[model samples]
Target: MSSPGPRSSVSPSGRSWRDRRLDRDGSLGLRLTLAAVAAFLVLVPFALLAVLVVGSWTPLHELDAAVTAALHRFAADHPGWVRVMKAWTHVFSPGPLRVAALAVVVWVWRRGSRRLALWVVTTMAVGGALGALLKLLVGRDRPELLDPVARAAGFSFPSGHALNATLAAGVLLLVFLPFARGRPGGRLLLWTVAVLLVGVTGLSRVALGVHWASDVLGGWLLGGAVVAATAAAFRTWREQAGLPAGRTTVDGVAPELVDPHA
Candidate 1:
């Protein structure tokens, strides 16, 4: 049998191909929420850095000496554990894993959910770049502790690994939160994983002696701020685009589909 004629598939209003896929709703509350989050995200990192500079400046010089002494003590007692911790921390190095994250984000955005994909990509890109820029501006030094397993040659005020993981995980939480909002079990699982990833990544930097406690804290704050900002921008764009409000399913059967990509 022949396929249905073009008329059968065309929208009766003859809306343009692109127009049919757009949504058209804008909640005042959502716009406000997005704006607040974005503003917070943009400012928090700088504040975090300032705090770190003030609080950790002196302690940083002493940190390496402390770490060296601790390492010597640990080596005499538990050398195997030290090696294991180094390997675990090295696994989180941003070089190769970041490339993988990029690929995953692109693939998910193109094939599955643009909103989720954008969440991942935006958080990582913005947060990682910001962290690097902050490090450059500060131009601090890494601890001269036991030789680093992963060679990150740059100023070490805000830990990049900590920031990257924190942003990525935080955005994932936000994206999933809407759907799981009322479902306590699902929400708990989602948030728990997100927290673990963010927290563990931060701790790993400290465990490896690449960052001071303050740097990790700064990175977390910096990353969270970016996620909030990106989420706000996304919500604003969604509102302005006026796509169908609320969640959309995987299939294109809703009243209208919002192109988050737009």
Candidate 2:
């Protein structure tokens, strides 16, 4: 009789050897678990904040009032500071962030990573749209400060500036982090800049007396949830395509971008 055929290497589930290795390593499971946990943590607070804002919770309202009043007073006294914040907010506003993301999308698309480019566009578009819808649904008003140093129009539970800043920061960090792979300092600097941009942009919205602290906080939480959710989805797609499950915190969302021939 003919020799038995070589033993099949494929798993019972039809996964290849590489996929079986990935399953044994548990990297994909860990990544998805972390992303789910992150999303849950952020969304819970955001939901609480929304509920409180809608219910007009006394303590939260009082805190918002106090913070807004304090910031307004400071803005009223410091003309230079107000001017700087205005410039900073404008530079990081939704319009500019969209333009920057568009540039990145174009670059990546040209580089043949159409899916990565599409991911960027979808994340930004969905985040912005959802934020706008939440504002309308919440029907929360912007902080009405006496002698306001800056003005913003529309419902303001989530500060548009803060949300857009956060979306932009996450998008840019994930897109560019691949280039900083081997350089620890470069990675640190990238993370530092992203954090500062998100933090200060939110703070500026409050300091300008256009958004309450809670509004900025809500923006941040929602924006973070969107990024985490999208990153998790992208990682799953990569795994299905037989690509490495690169960690977003280290290897970024698209490690293949670092390959010149890719």
**Residue pairs that clash (backbone atoms under 3 angstroms), model 1:** 23-242, 23-243, 23-244, 24-242, 24-243, 25-242, 38-229, 41-225
Q: Pick the candidate with the highest TM-score.
A: 2
| Model 1 per-residue lDDT tens digits across residues 1-262 | 9987666565536756344334233243445554765577577666955665855556644764575456445544666765766665667666655776777577656655767576677678878888888888777677664554434577887888778777766655554454454577877787788788778777766665667666777787887777767766665665566644353111211122233344
Q: Report the lDDT tens digits of candidate 2 across residue range 28-125.
A: 55545556676787688889899999999999999999999988898899999999999999988999999999999999999989989989998899
Best-fitting candidate, scored by lDDT: 2
Error at 145, model 1, angstroms = 3.2
Per-model RMSD to reference: 12.1, 5.2
| Model 2, runs deviating above 4 Å | 1-38, 260-262
Error of 2 at 151 (Å): 1.2
CA-lDDT, candidates in order: 0.63, 0.88
lDDT of 1 at 36: 69
